[model samples]
Target: MRVKSEIWIRAYLRRCQAEGVPAVVVRRGDEAAGAIFICVDRLDGSVALYGPAPAGIEGGETERRWVACFKTATASGAEVSAYLARQSRFDSDLWIIEIEDKQGRHFLGEDAIIE
Candidate 1:
């Protein structure tokens, strides 16, 4: 028997939601690209996102665009969370997160974050 990824994805998101995780579906344009989320499974504020592997010169480029949009937030240090939540790209589709660093890095954590 084969399992549909979209089905599993929804199940995962629902489980994450019940667990009080802050998960969101990251979309690019209007297609479901991926997601950036977090859950209680993580002790630190690590963020977990799942999507297509970064591709094309436009991969990182797309993330940069989102970074700029997320800059509008004035939080002391919650861009990762704010970004995944307020990003408008998901208004239609899912976008990929490709940047990494201490200031901000997309970490695949143990917990789940749902939107």
Candidate 2:
């Protein structure tokens, strides 16, 4: 179980809030978490949503919840696509959505669909 460093999480949250997305931190199993979770960000010149490969992603409550947090950050409409697509290394089962997160706040907007 790999928990995101406090520095990283805080920075991420700050950045998201600054962008008006207001980065949210939720425990992995928290009901608030969506089914497909992601850790959203931008690497280089594009957007990215990352998560630990689900292959053997297992652990206790704390671990599981953090993992969930990681995933939710990148899920649909969370706005982390192009950066992930640019990754030269990634898992096959990893759902790299094509839609980018834009300024539209509509529920299930065009960017909400999984790719």
Candidate 3:
């Protein structure tokens, strides 16, 4: 059984808050199973995006390897925005979270595959 999208998002936000990282939900999607996309603003005039992996890629893997966690090399705001806009168009129900951190800490915890 998977955790509902909204519940997972709320928990993520709380975890960020506890760690003193500024995080915000840029866009909200369906409460049930919408895919989550995180935008990390490095605060150095650059941003990067991350999203979950497909079922085929993550299935049968450990929780730590569930998400593909692809990262865009830090780029200009316009470039990041353009990429995100394209994604938003393709998935209207996608949830977008923006995290402002100088070190690019996404607070993904231990259950993420950061590659």
Candidate 4:
């Protein structure tokens, strides 16, 4: 079975803190099963957004996969905000996590497949 959304998010926050990265949950969603979106602020003018990958990508059913939300490697803050607004309207149960790292580290590891 898959891990609950709340449990996964708490663990992820701990991991980020351990790595010395400042991360915070901007918006809280369902505790059971909610889509997660991550925003990596580069501390510059650009940002990177990652959302849950489509099913049957590569990871197992119990694993959470992510994909870049933009065509380019990074996008403007305004652009990211607009995309996230649309997403929030579509899925109110989606969680939003923002990480402030000058290196633009998302810490997604092998679970992320940039497209």
How much does candidate 1 score in TM-score? Answer: 0.29
Residue-wise C-alpha lDDT for candidate 2, range 1-115, written one tens digit per residue: 3344444345545655565663455322222222223444332333334343344334422343222222333334333344344432342323222222354221222323333
TM-score of each: 0.29, 0.28, 0.83, 0.96
Best model per lDDT? 4
- Candidate 3 lDDT over 1-115, as tens digits, reads 5777899899989998998889999899989877788778888897766777666554324232234333446667787678778877998998988999899887776555556
Superior by lDDT: candidate 2 or candidate 4: 4
Candidate 1 lDDT (Cα, whole model)? 0.37
Q: What TM-score does structure 2 among the candidates reach?
A: 0.28
List candidate 1 stretches off by more than 4 Å: 28-115
Q: Worst 10-residue stretch by lDDT in candidate 3? A: 59-68
Q: Which stretches of candidate 2 lie over 4 Å from their true place?
A: 1-4, 28-49, 52-115
Candidate 1 structure quality by residue, lDDT tens digits, 15-71: 556655554544333223333222211334443333333234243434311122322
Distance from true location, Cα of 82 in model 3, Å: 1.1
**What overall lDDT, based on C-alpha atoms, would model 3 receive against the true structure?**
0.75
lDDT of each: 0.37, 0.35, 0.75, 0.93
